[model samples]
Structures are given as structure tokens and as C-alpha cells.
Target: MIVERLIIADNQPLTAYAVEALSRSVAQEIHIEDLEIAYAQNKTQLNNLLRDGKKTAVVVDYTMFDFTNQENFTIVCDLYQNTSCWLLLSEELTPNFLRYVVYQTQNVGVAYKDASLDSMREALHYVMTGVRYISQQATQILLQKAAEAENRRDELTHTEREILKAIALGKTTKEIAADRFSSVHTINSHRKNIFRKLGVNCVHDAIKYALRAGLVDESEFFI
Candidate 1:
């Protein structure tokens, strides 16, 4: 495969090394297109160049122009809309952030900036072949972060967790209110706050989240 690579990285040595590691056919056609730093000069033209270019693998840095920022991500959104196959060169990547990047494109791959030659080579090779390359570091970090988030989940207020458990157990608002020795209005207010904190819209969705987060166990319910 010709495997056209459009790099938006500032580190020429790293990018050049990556280009060299690609399939032999691709090794010869390393095009920087427009440098990522060019966005600092004129983002409009930079986005235009990216948007107008042919559909190919885009290798860009996570630190390139504050790419995670909403304003900068708008440009990234536009770029992926007009391109395909993104390989992100990152520094210290988080699971949530990596997940966001993966959602933005097809066949997404992330490689740490300080990755060894083998890691870079493997990531690029997998990306060029239309495969997802999530490095060992990224996966391990994601798992560790998930555990940390689970611990944070335990920090919810006692009342909030009681309301959440009741909701998960399929109690109606009035039923929950009666059980808590409170009025329906108070229960509803708590329910609203629960939804807000859980980042969910409906009871079913909240229940699903609660199950996933280990906040509630269905087996514990009494008949």
C-alpha cells in the first residue's frame, strides 16, 4: 500500500522516524502537508488545507495548538470530518481524553511522545493497516483511572446514594418519599439532583450506570 501519511507534528525527528517505520511503500512519501504550528499563524488556512486534503492517515500531536481545548477541537472536528485514520502523538494521555479522541475519528491510534522506537513503529503500522493501536501504557492508565473514578463514586452523599439505590431498585417517586419519611416534592428534588450528579437523564439510564459503577446490586433486593 502507498499509505499516504499527512503529519502535523513539530518533532521532525520523531515524525521522520515514524515515517521511516511505516510500510516500505509509505516510507518514501512522507508529506508534512501544513505543519501543526502553522495553525498558530492562521488556523483558517491550516484547517482549510487539512479539510481539502485527500483522505489518508493524519498523524498529529496532542499538544499541537492545545488540541484538547474546545476551540482547537472545533478545528480537529473539521479536520476529521474531511479526513480519515488519525494517529495522535501524545504526552501524558488520560483515558477520558483518549476516548474523546477515538470518538472523533475512525481507526484511531495513540502513542506516547516518549515511546520507544518499537512502540512508535507498531502504532504506525497498525494505524496504516486500518487497525486500532491503543498502546499498553494507554490501556493500563485507563484501567487505573477507572479504578480511581470508582473510588470517587463512593464519595457521593449518603442521602444521594440512598436515593440512587432506591431508583435502581425501581421505586416510584412517591414510594421513595414515603419510605424516606419525606414528601413527594422533596423526593423529586433529590431525584433531580441525583440525575444531575450522575450525568444521566432517565431512571433506567441511572440504574444502568449504578450497576456499572457498583453503586447498587440487583441481587440485594427483597421481594
Candidate 2:
């Protein structure tokens, strides 16, 4: 689990210095060869470093990096199988983005930029060891989202839940009726009941609830 290279891909100078200092300390303690430390101010430099296909560990503040989107960052990470990343998040990143990144990548660890030195060191150790590490702040956001989704699922009846899933899949009332061998009126009534139970007033909200509740996969919902 020796990290041959450590890339600090953050634009903020002070933050990068602090992470570099902490990383160097951990590397020294672990005897990780005083790994080559590189600074990537932008994506091109980051890509070039990763293209070397070495056992590299990266600590990046994605919010400040030039990635066009979270998916763009994911794409870059996916490109280098020999590389692992530790996300240095800021408080401004949204809960959904946090969840998306945590779920989307296997070789990425997450910690806030303001995290304690110990937490940062632990995250570095985990990422370099090919393990996942999520900070307390990010874990709270994910747990809260999971609780809300569970509550939404618990509030709906079986029929209402099925109807909501159908709606999320873009099925019309008529189509749902046809699939269930029921009248369109019955499907429409179930849709209304779903809205009432979920405290939503419209189909779009019900569909959103279904997506969040895990009744429908995100890809299915989008399609």
C-alpha cells in the first residue's frame, strides 16, 4: 500500500500546504518513500500526472478544481485504475453531490477541508490502502437523506407505492391501468392517494419522492 506519488490538486494555497504537511507526516511515519508531491492547479495537469499509471494518491478540493461537473471528476478518476483520490470538500457542497460522489466511486475517500489533522491523515491512509473513508459531516448528510427516503416509503400504501413507481417510470394513468388490469379511474385515484400520503400536491413531486425513496433507480427515473 505504498503511495509512490501524492498529488495535491487544490487551488487554495494555504489549504494545499496544510494537506501537504499532514500527508508528508503520515508518509514519513508509514515509510512511504517520501513520495513525489505534485500540485495540479487544473484538470490537464491532473490528467497528465494520472496518465503515468503509477500508484498515486490525490487529495483534491473538487469545488475549487476546474472539473466541469461532479461527473467530470468521476470520469477522470475512473480513467486511472492505479490512482486513488481523497476528496477535500468544502461546506458549500450540497448534500446530493456528497451522496452522489460517495456512491459513484469506489476508490475515493471524502473529508472536509476543515477536518482535523487526524481525520485527514486517516482519510489518506484509507485511500492509499484502497479503502473507503467518509467524514462525519458527509456521513450525516447521507444518513439524513436515507431517513427521509425511508419515511417517505413508510407513508405510502402498497397500491399508492406501485402507482408512484409507475409514474416515476413515466407511465400514464391509462398505461398503469392496462398493466394492472384496472380502470384508469382506479389508477388515478391511487395516484391522488399517493400525493396525499406523501404530502405532495402534484405528479412531479410524487415522481421525485419515488426516486428518492429508492422505489425507482435514478437511471430508470431519468429515462
Candidate 3:
């Protein structure tokens, strides 16, 4: 049987080697579409590539440009809309971020950047078989964030609550900034306030607070 096509949307040379090596173990032929620092340069091409696949799996880096943009998110949503396979390669599995990516991706797969190559390969394999994949660390972080959010209920303000909602939903500071027409620094400041109010120290904690408080739903965040 022909293995499903695997496209790695990364702009790093190291990733080219890593993903290529990983794909070689499962796919008959590994194709690399290395944007190599200019990924966002050819938005049209990337959109076309995503739209062309029938049964395809795309692995995208979390910081891979503005996937949070409404239009871009729409394109990504369209790409994996009904394809049943997609994946995100994120630097960390913080619920605050993954929630957004997962919501956009339709929950295909979520792999951490620091995970073993075998784990990534396994995730790809699972998706091929119509099952979702999420790293262990990602899963734990998600649960913890949910628990923390629950524990800290009344300390958050209405706006702080909304910021937490956005963060847990996986919207980036830049995306939130754009949507709110505020500066990135301002969004970040809001994030800091969220952390303080939630009694958490980082993005992970804020996510837990948001989840626990029902500011954001569990299904809205993953990976």
C-alpha cells in the first residue's frame, strides 16, 4: 500500500534531516518541502499544497508564521477540514498554545519539538490509521493546566478572563494583538496578569487556570 503523503512545514535545516529520517522509516518516498526561513514568503504555494491533498498529513511548526490569522486559519482548517490527518510540531505542549492549534487543526495530531524521532514517527503512523496522537508530556501538561484553572476561580477579572480564554484557546500573542488591535507587548502584559491572577508562573499554569475556571473548554485545547 502507498503510504500517506507526509509534508513537513519547517524552515530549519535540522528539521529537514530529522523529519526526513523519521519519514524514511514509514514512507516509501520522503518528500521535503523546506521553506528554510522563507515559509511565509509563498503563502499561495503553501495554500495550494495543502488544498491538493486528498488523504494527507501535514506537520507544521507552532511558530510557523501566522496560522492564527483568520484567513490562514481558514486555509489550514480547509486543508484538514475532512482529510482526517494533520499534525503540529510545537516547541512546547503548553495548553495555552496547543488549544488554539488543535482547535484549528481539527485534532489530527500534536507532537512536541523535543520528542524522540520515534515518537513523532509513531504519531504519524497513528494518524494514518485514523487515530489522533498527542505526546505524553503534552497530555500531562493539558490535564495539569485544567486542574490549576479550576483551583483558581475568583481571582480573575472579566478582561483577564477573556485573555485567559484566548490563551487557552491557542491564540498567539500576535494573533490576539491583531484581533484586539493592540500591541504584542500589551497582549504579553495581559498574559503576565493572567499568570499572576491565576497564581501560576507560566503559560502552562495560565492554561490550567482557564480550563479549571471554565473560561475555555478542554476540547478547545490540546497537544
Number of the top-ranking candidate, with lDDT as the measure: 2
TM-score of each: 0.59, 0.74, 0.58
Query: Which residue ranges in model 2 land beyond 4 Å of their true spot?
Result: 154-160, 165-174, 177-223
Q: Give lDDT tens digits, candidate 3, residues 1-223.
A: 1224555667676875677566655553233233121132235555666565545556666476445553464456565566635567768545656655554455457888788867877876665445667778777776786567565567667777787788888888899899888999988887887776565666875676566667787877875
Model 2, 13-95: lDDT tens digits are: 98889878887888777778757889999999998888877788888888898999988988888877556555555646777
Best first by lDDT, ranked? 2, 3, 1
Flag clash pairs in model 2. none
Better candidate by lDDT, 1 or 2: 2
lDDT for each residue of candidate 1 in 131-150, tens digit (9 for 90 to 100): 66788887777667556646
Q: Model 2 lDDT vs. the true structure?
A: 0.78
What lDDT score belongs to each candidate, Candidate 1 first? 0.62, 0.78, 0.64
What TM-score should be assigned to candidate 1? 0.59
The predicted structure with the larger TM-score, 2 or 3, is: 2
